[model samples]
Target: MTATSASTTSAGPAGVDVAQFADVTASDASLRRFLHGLPGVDQVGCEARAAGLGTRSIKTTAKAQALDLAIRMVDLTTLEGMDTPGKVRALASKAMRPDPADPTCPAAAAVCVYPDMVATAKDALGDSGVHVAAVATAFPSGRAALDIKLADTRDAVEAGADEIDMVIDRGAFLTGRYLQVFEEIVAVREACARPDGTAAHLKVIFETGELQTYDNVRRASWLAMMAGGDFIKTSTGKVQPAATLPVTLVMLEAVRDFRAQTGRMVGVKPAGGIRTAKDAIKYLVMVNEVVGQDWLDPDWFRFGASTLLNDLLMQRTKMTTGRYSGPDYFTLD
Candidate 1:
């Protein structure tokens, strides 16, 4: 697949050039044509590539380093309805110190929770360098009206969330109402801004399982980036087949191509269904191979997970002390 170039100088939201993509998002037809015209995924080839990369192994010192990097790249998430302020505080504490036994262990990239929990998380993680991320736009369902969605985003931002993860209207996108989805993302991105001028970073969740095909994943990635999303995320962790290796591969390719085409970089987050340290390592390998070192940092790539941290801690302990620690040693998420 080749990167498509857009030429126009005017600036748009999130530093994107609006005029550059003006022709593409001019209307529903134009947006659909552009998204459809993009390269299609070769399912066999894509899955094959993911499988091959998954087999690449790290060992000894390299394995230890990979474990540390993976720990830092985690967005320690807890989105259950039963979540309490105390639970969020505990989660935030864990995010700041994943392995309390080992002070050398790196803190996670963020503590993700519902909008109502952002303030609790913020208070728990004050001045810790770890970010507070809130899932908005009606979260797992993204079924609310645009006004409600924007208000959700504003609530999170106002509550001191450093990042906002908004779900797109997959219903609209699937029905070929690409313009509607695009506009909603743009609006939410706007709502992430604080009164102090610096805005919470926006992570657009496509809930890729609902998107169905790899080709649609690519289309959604581009649409979110074009609409000023700082990051394009895979799932909401509430659906089947969340964040598969092949699907993430497609998204990695999209961000890589997008940066090449527009000179703007967007982050990718693969959420849910990734539980083991080994599984996280495979994703790290894929990111290295697919997009190179540029996306190796937490700022560019994050694993949206709750249970993955425990396994990583276990692996770290085993590597450090030459013995395996049972899962009981770590606090459950």
Candidate 2:
């Protein structure tokens, strides 16, 4: 195992309970076998596909291309707080429509709006095949009570969200309240689980910008996985000095290590500040080199971008015809 640098934060969160999770029992033998079973190209296979992949960093660049199925998880921060239920619904519908001129315009993974807009999104996506994801649990700043957070999660799911993105109590985690952070995630996971027999994917955002150290990021990733994060994400995009390559590398390796120990595949998403095709590709390459190419699929990887899709469309258009395309051609509006 690669040892990470020591954390500079003074042991995240106060009084967090850590020993309550059982998923930590997932052993290395089981995890390694599971990772090997997943499909992917090896170093040689990567080399073979690299030439056709279009970029020298095929591992990285491939993400934007494969991201035809991406979900732009955006916050509906309506000005003047004017989003009535109906207006919120319409906003979500508009957010999900993809550009047909682009071959990559399959369907978005979902329209991630506010909790109140989930039902609207669920209705908007309809049989149209997109999912409805909501950011819950005192989002942007997870400073609410446990009950309120859980209620926030339940309300979003009840409102028809297919998935939930919850913020980890960074204060708790940074203060070494790992156990409290773990418990908060576990409660939300339990609430989000389909008691009616369905299951919802949960993406836990570490907001790596605040963790301040690769070691802490690595430790936090491990804790989140142990507590049951279906996907581990870099930031909420609300933090400054957003998603950096080095921080993402730390998170990716944590996923790799978690898979090595748990026999499960946890996804990774680098949100916030990722606005260019090149930036998206860099994340793709990091996953390829660190986690292996099998995770190249949409199921194992995701990008929480707003402006990223447009840049990718423009780049793809330019590449196909050998010329530049106007920005208005791919308006995310």
Candidate 3:
């Protein structure tokens, strides 16, 4: 979709300031009209562009640099029903020192876990550069009441989470209750605030797989950005077809257009289905070509991954030794 300069920074559709869009939650029709009016996605064209970007050749020193950058941009994630204190600690350690054998490897951007594990993760990552991120708002399914969702967010923030990855109410969104979804995000964003005056950054997940169309992905991206999302994430990593290149491409285009219009930069995270160093580099290539060098840093981009870090470390090891290493050589996440 196209974003006009007047539409970006100062006000979104119908004179709503994107930086402070929480005011528009009163009307669903206004939000719906604004979202549906965004540029339609050409699915074939979008997929072709993603495939073309996937073919980029990165090797030698360039590959090495990409590997390190990808590592630093990872949100080393461990979201499972059986997640435990020990598992969170081990993952937190991995986030801090991805490659225990190599002191030079930088830490992952954050450690993403369930809200219940936020305190454990925060304590485990004490004094480390890595941030603690917790998934909230009923997590994979946004089927709970607004008060419950806000409570979920507050619990994580109170537990010392630095970031909150929240899933939107997909049922409401798909049913065309756009304002309901928007207000939910605004409420969650408010709950991210702490008594100390600092606030946890909010990453809103669209679960593109369920959205089922590039048009919906584009619309959702803009909706979240306008609603004050710090980052617009592709998927929850629990759904099928999570984090595909085409979905991510649509998001990157949205962010680029959004920034051009409002001068506000929103981060993008492609969670799920992204494995291997090659896949990670392909995504990085797409980001560079689509969003440009401005989003290359971890602060503006992230990969929500659990096993992806080990693969990156393995590739980084190969780049250093000129020989491929086995999975055993790297610590399991």
Candidate 4:
């Protein structure tokens, strides 16, 4: 329950003290026992809490602040097979200046794109303070071999990605091969290391929809954190049932508890299906309540979304000018 729990003095991935989890990751059997031993989620209670939080209202000034915060939290993203360099450049531009009409609009947290597009996004975002995040490790599916996955991550980091979002092997996770998934995450985290010795922040995607149970979600959250993931993400945005409130609640709890026990903080990102200012506000409230304000900043939380930015801008405009802006006022992602 503490960082000194393990007797070994070596450090693990992500600078976690190896001794803290020496017993837990000693072998596949030990990892399975430790993960399976975690407390099971109370499905009914979790959903009820999420629904209750979703109903809380913020009005006028508070709502205005929430909208701006949501805008800043967005990972303005585009990941499609047909995505072109021009489109990525446009997205990067939008990320740096979400609302051309207003100079005060805080830039989005980052522009998320495929590995091959990282350079383009990096070029467009150029010193704007908006990070370029690339999804690697066979993103959305994660069906490739470990070597290929590491290579995918290295390519992204080499291409100037400020962050690397790698998908976990959900199949291995579901089959209870906890160590395989853990090792792969560790490998990808290592691949994120840059020549300057600073590593690109690593976000491990769970694709929670495929994991099929709240318990598995909790286990995966702990597993990724133990393996040195800077962030534990809810989905790759390519799967159905992505980023549900209850699932995110479970993950938030995991990070809170992990920090309590290990003194290391891990971020949570709920990607996909969050499309409105109201939805983003609900998540903000949840993060405040479930993990405290420590995770409220863009550095600690993110909305992996495309359309969500437009809604935040619209709400922000309504608050500032007392009128609704048409969707045409914003560029469609």
Candidate 5:
């Protein structure tokens, strides 16, 4: 590999040691509470658990709270901003509909929306405690100029996005220009800052699956963290193999190690392709096993899922009320 000079020379500032951040302990009650508070997760995650048991494949790993926490870690929200204006209006209307069993619940994080719809989300969430996140930096491609990217981020924040997700140019990162990616992330992170000087949380999407290997994943994770990624996300869910376990495992370890070295608590977001309760739980178990549990909170973890919420609600209904519900009961529409 191409070991660039700046990455070697820059060790970050005083007490802000990136190397000391990954050592935090895992497993805790706080993480548990944060996850259980979420609205949906039963459709796929719990369905996976039930399906596995029905087939007698494996039923021993059912840690409800852990699984629940995993489900809660999910951002059951969606992307209404990508589609046409008609689609956006339809989705906004769907957001207004109430579920008899599940109701309109707050997701793990705010739904990721286009900048124009930020106000709709803010009004929809209405201080419900769920974050209102927006994608910035020429999302899904990030091929725009830096100034435009920064302007987009500012607009989203002004429109009421609580978190801003910015994409780095994969072209630059892949060609071995680590500094370019680093500078862009730092600039975008700065762009996300609030008026009080405290920046809105920034989740940097590495689109790890697009990268070649685990080593590249590790390297990119390091670069993003070093540049100030509040959360290291896996994909935009726009690409294939969005949130594979192996890739997520690598990211989890990177965060764990980073914490051990820097004392900073960076979060991990395994977005895209995660559809079931079992998948959600596996992610949780992996986090507990690999990162130790301290990273389980919504603050340190989140799943970008449009389908997971239904599965979670179904499971809860089955356990409490003992009946399976239709998908219509859980979906946004």
Candidate 6:
């Protein structure tokens, strides 16, 4: 198919325009048919491609640029049950000033927190270029009523969340209730619009680990994109197998194809398990080769991590000083 420029107003895959989700979601069979009809994923080929890309050489200046880009693309997160205002304040401070010693470092893309901490994070973040992103819609499990989920999203947006990371109802998705999941995403997307009308971007998390198959991941990626996801994320970081190279490769291909088909570019975030500067640089290499340089920007991509920052900083220090810096040198947070 010849690629057509994507307009929120135009009809999407299976003739379901984002605005017409309510109508399209009226039939369960239609939703299932649409999802299952998507192209199948070649598991071996995908994994092999990702592994090969991981071997690409990124040395000297290019490596430094990739490290900085990865640092800027991080969603510095702390989502524990024991989270407190003080904890969030400290995290937000660290996010704003990732490297107090080196003013050259860029701020993280956002500081992710629970809906209740949005205001605290916003306050702590102040006028810093960093954004406040809140996880909502019963994140991690996404097993809540539509009304409650929408309310959760609204609460965060009202509290000044510039972005919302929401998890899909994995149970519903796995049970073949595609329409229900599709409608839920549509509802959350509607809820993300602020009162003044400028809206927070919505990232739909698939938790690919639970989805259990590459085909499911591919289908979910398309489902979220068609439902108006600004970014299709890999996991919630609460799962055992949060993010991995093959899963990220699949998601990258999904976004690339979605843009090719609809002419709209959505971002991708591979949360969880990305801990080292080497790991991050590998992902950068995948993005650069798989989808080209267009998706390299922080706006178009993000890494949902906290520890990954320190590693990147350490490697960056090593690159600059010609020696590796100990973990003690970086802020603990």
Off by over 4 Å in 4: 1-7, 12-14
Whole-model alpha-carbon lDDT for candidate 6: 0.87
**Candidate 3 lDDT tens digits, 1-333:** 234444444532223354454334437766777788888999899999999999998878898899999999999999999999999999988889888888999889999999999999999999997999999999898888889989999999899999999999888889998887887787788788777666898999999989978999998998888778889998898899999998999999999998887678999999998889999999999999999999999999999988898889988988798888887988776
Q: For candidate 2, give the lDDT of residue 297.
A: 67
Prediction 5 global C-alpha lDDT = 0.68
At residue 28, what lDDT does model 1 achieve? 90
**Per-residue alpha-carbon lDDT of model 1 for 10-111, expressed as tens digits?**
544445555567778889988898999999999999999999999999999999999999999999999998999999999999999988888999999999
* Ranking of models by lDDT: 1, 4, 3, 6, 5, 2
lDDT of 6 at 242: 91
Q: Model 2 residue 56 lDDT?
A: 42
For all candidates, the clash counts are 0, 19, 4, 1, 39, 0
lDDT of 5 by residue, 1-333 (tens): 122343433333222233322221012232223223323323355345434433332233364565456555765445644555555444443333323444533335446677777777777667557677788888888899999999999999888888888887989878766666767887787777677656678899988778866666766777787677889999988988787777777677778876775567789998898877767777777777678768878888998877776676666556555577777666552
Q: Clashes in model 1: which pairs?
A: none
RMSD of 5: 10.4
Q: Is candidate 2 or candidate 4 better by TM-score?
A: 4
| Model 4 vs. true fold: TM | 0.97
Error of 1 at 196 (Å): 2.4
Against the hidden reference, what TM-scores do the models get? 0.96, 0.76, 0.93, 0.97, 0.77, 0.93
lDDT at position 191, candidate 4: 88
- Report lDDT (Cα) of residue 222, candidate 2: 74
Q: Which tens-of-lDDT digit does each residue in 17-71 have in candidate 2?
A: 2232333324544333333333332335433443333244543344435444233
